[model samples]
Every structure is written in structure tokens, then in C-alpha cells.
Target: MAVLEGDCEDSVSDSAKSCQTQSCTNCGGDGSCNMNSVCNNGCLPGFYSLACAQSCGKCGGNGSCNRLSRFCDESSCLPRYFGPLCIQLCPLNCGGDGSCDFQTANCLQGCKSRFSGTRCELSVACPSSTCRDPCQSINGGICTSGCRSGYFGEICNRVCNCQNNGACVQDTGVCESISQTTSVTVPTKFSDGKTAYQRAPAEGDPNNYGS
Candidate 1:
């Protein structure tokens, strides 16, 4: 008589020995003998999954998977393309006109017009000096369009050396040279600067800032 097991009917063939516990029919007793379970035949040479429903195609030669299809596809973006789908056109508004390979999310070949560094993430750094010009080396200034300490001129190039309580104006980047015994010098240059500096900070920097 056939014995009942979970969802499977266990029975011995007429010619077989006395009834015995049967292994899985799917894996052929490969230790994964469970009923209704899928087959894992190693599937072709590059196929995967127990059911082998996914195929990596010829692009799988490089051992890379396509994010969209989960198949073996190009690991990196192709020429002129740089995105997971290899769809982003190069030299777009990636970063300072940097060249971004959307496929890999990297700035390969080269960065945008003025951008530089990895992924074109770094902008032109300012020059070094006691009172470094905010936009010394780059077209824009560090503090945007504003007057520096002890300075009050177009582009904040003039020195005001106000010998009293003074402070730079907000937004306008103007300096208020308020001297104890002298009148305060109002600001002249207007601040007009916009930046998209990456929030990723150094090791000690606050992690929540970018969040």
C-alpha cells in the first residue's frame, strides 16, 4: 500500500525492495529531495536560479549582471554612456560639466568643462594665503560675492582694516566696518553665489548634516 506523506504519495515499485522513505524527486536525492521544489541543474553554463528563469545573455561573459534584467551584462557603461542602463549621455550637467558614465555612476574619460577630480566631484580649490580670496583661483569666491575681513571694494578687493567692532553682512557679503571712534563703512559688493558642494564630510564631520 502507498503511504501518505505531506503533499506526496510515497509508494514502492513492485520490483523494488520493501517500502522505504523516498528522497526528493526533483534533486534525485542530491540531499535536496523535497517535493514541489524547483530543479537546480546548474542550468546551461552561465544560467542561475533553481528554476533557471533568468539568463545573462552574451554580456554575461564579463561576469557582470544587468541591474534591470539581473542578467550578465556590461559591468561598466559603454562609450558615451555612463549609467546602469548605459543610457546617460556623456558631458551632460553631471558635475561642472564633468563627463559622467551613468552606467557606473562615475566621471570617466574626463570631468565637465571646469570640474576635476574623481567623478568630477572636486571643484577648483581656492588659492592659499593669509586672507585667501574666496574665489581666488576659481571663478566664484568661497564666501560668494561678499567683502572679506578688513576689505570693502568691488568683489571685496578693498581693505577696510576697521580698528573696532565689525562684521560682514549676511547674503550681501558686505562688511560693516563699525569703528569705536569712527563711522562704519557700509558694504559695496553684493553677494551672489550658489554652490552644490557634496554633503559627504570628512571622518570627523557630522554624518547627520547631509541627512
Candidate 2:
């Protein structure tokens, strides 16, 4: 009887040890076991592993990582950050007013009127004093507003020399003038419509009016 009781106690002790081993292994040490004995607690936010021991890659604290794959969740990236791991920053700060492409970092909208280039990093080249009326029809180095007085041509770099109160053509820089000439004529009138005849006897006279 003593031997039998001892064996029974030993058997109970072995059973308890087995139960504890099964309970601990159910969750693979990576998650908590639920009431149904199913592993459901999953790894922490940025960590993933069978035992929740590995850390997620650097996501600049802007996104969450997948528990199973340890990859960053792009949809959760911070405002200005983008890319697979949310590691890249949007370029040009969206040119101050526009937005940037989340994947390519390119500008979603065009730059402002005062700016140009793919990233809007370059300033629009407006005409200067040398070109006259810098803001008039500004287009790079070309002076579409036309040069100021005394200046002419596409760049407004050419000087003009108009003569005799002449003005230079804005497009060609050629001198132009507006001068005119006039003439006058006088007509003689006769007292009578018929011709007058002098007497032949008076031809020899020294005081003849016909002479």
C-alpha cells in the first residue's frame, strides 16, 4: 500500500510539470495566451519576433512596422516623410505652397510665377534696368516689353543715333523722319479778252509807244 501511494503521488507531480510546460510553450514566448489557450497578444509596436526580441528598422519614429515582416507601414508615415520605411523627406518643402509626391519626392503642382525649374529652386529671370521695364513681358533674358527710349533690340543692349529730330524704330533701331515740301504759282490776267494793234504810221516816230 505504501509503494502504491508513493507511485500515485509521483504520477501527479509529473502531470503538473507537463501542464506547466504546455502552458508556457503555447504562446511561443512571444505573446500572451488567451482564455481559449490561443496565442493572441502579438509583439509590441516596433518589435517583432517569435519571442518579440527583434526591433523594427529605423522608421524615424514616423510609422509602424509589420509584426510578421518587420517592414514599415508607409501609410502611417508622418506629414513630411515618405518612402517604404518613411525614411525620406519630401523635397523643396513642396515649394512652400504646393505638395510633394509621396513616393517620388517630386512636386505635385507647378511652382509659383516667380519661380521655375523641376523643384522650383530657381528664381524666374526677369529683365533688369539694362533691359528697361524689367517686369514688362518678362521672359528670361529677352526684353519683350521693348527697350526704353534711346535703347532698342531684343536685349535692349543696342544704342540708337537718330539724326535731324528723327526717332529710332523700337524694333529695328532705324532712324525715321516726317518732312514735306510745298510750291506756289501766280497767273497773269488781261484787261480785255482780245489783242490790241498799234497804227503803222506811228512806226517811224521816235516817241511811238509800240517801239
Candidate 3:
């Protein structure tokens, strides 16, 4: 709804003409005649014009793009971002919003927590109290890989010391197939000598002679 630069034409003279009427005669609610009687109206938010059609490319702070050029206003892009559309991300670990200079790639405002360096590129180690795995400093400071033996958890902090010579699953710490524990459950056998070694769970016998 803001006034943007434009001019009413004089076909023969090829120049802007003063208003003949007192107020604007022809224009939509979104359009206007300026104080100087110049025909002007900024485009609706997200729309540049019928020629460009549709959304204005991610202007910073949700500001409207210029109606004609559609370029973002200077310093209008979000922090740590820049480019034709302001969709480009700043280098990793930049501090405040708009902190990364799109031109220089430096964190001019300093680094985010747990990240250090002129450009905020280095990862600072998290204390074991917060993140148990030393692996947090590596792999972009995320510990997604499974924990070492004898430990398990989201952060691989919980102990997995299974009791009685039991082996634990690295993910869930559930005791599983180990020396003393047998998952195989043999079925009960019939009294007859032939059925003594038959399948355990099946009723009667393999010969079907005895119940």
C-alpha cells in the first residue's frame, strides 16, 4: 500500500502529466496517485508483478520485495544469510541473527555456544555431565552412532553392565544369548525311549503313539 515511483504518460509529449482531476480518477484500491500526481503503488506482499508472478523470494524480516525489481531491501535478509533470494545459509555456528556477513563469511557477532573460531567453524567439547560421549565433538557435535560396549542411551551415557555373565544389546541394554542363558526351549518328551529326544513343545510324541 506504499507509494512507489511511476508516472502517468502523455502519449505525444512522452512525459508525466499533472492530474486533470482533483483526486485520482482511475486506479484500484491497491493503487494510488501520489502527491505529485504520479501514478504509484507498491505491489502486494509476496507478489512482484504479473510478469514475475507469485511469492517474493524470502525477503528478510518478511519485508515486501520491491514491486518492479523484486530485489530484497539492503540489510533486509535474515542473519547469517545472503544471496539473490536470501535463502542461502551462513557458515555453521554463527551467533546472532544476521551475524554472518554474506560477503566475507565471518561471524562478525561472534560464535554460537559450543562453537568457536573467527568464523565459528570449530566445535567446543560438551561437558560429560551434559553429553556423555566424547564423540559429540566430532561428526558435527552430534552423537548419533551407537554407544561403546557396556554403555547405552540416547547419549550413550547409561551403563549396560548385565548381571550373571549376561550379554546386553548395545542399543537397549537387554541381556541376550550368552554363555549361561539359552533361548532354545526344548519341548517335554514322552516316557517311551523313542520319544525321549523328540521335540519339546509338541504334545504327545513324534511317533503320535503316546500323550
Q: What is the C-alpha lDDT of each candidate?
A: 0.40, 0.48, 0.51
Q: Per-residue alpha-carbon lDDT of model 1 for 91-155, expressed as tens digits?
A: 44244344454445555554433344555456644322313234432332243454445544334
Model 3: how large is the Cα RMSD against the reference?
15.8
Better of 1 and 3 by TM-score: 3
What TM-score would you give candidate 3 relative to the actual structure?
0.35
Best by TM-score: 3
Each prediction's Cα RMSD?
Answer: 18.9, 22.8, 15.8
lDDT of 3 by residue, 91-140 (tens): 77776663566456667666665666667789766333434344443333
User: Best by lDDT, which number?
Assistant: 3
Query: Sorted by TM-score, highest first, which candidate order results?
Result: 3, 2, 1
- Backbone clashes for every candidate come to 15, 0, 4
Poorest 10 consecutive residues by lDDT, candidate 3:
196-205
> Which lDDT value does model 1 have at 37?
30
Q: List the candidate 3 regions with Cα displacement exceeding 4 Å.
A: 1-29, 32-40, 97-99, 124-211
| TM-score for each of the candidates | 0.25, 0.31, 0.35
Those runs of model 1 whose alpha carbons end farther than 4 Å from true positions after fitting are 1-63, 66-141, 144-148, 151-158, 164-166, 170-177, 180-211
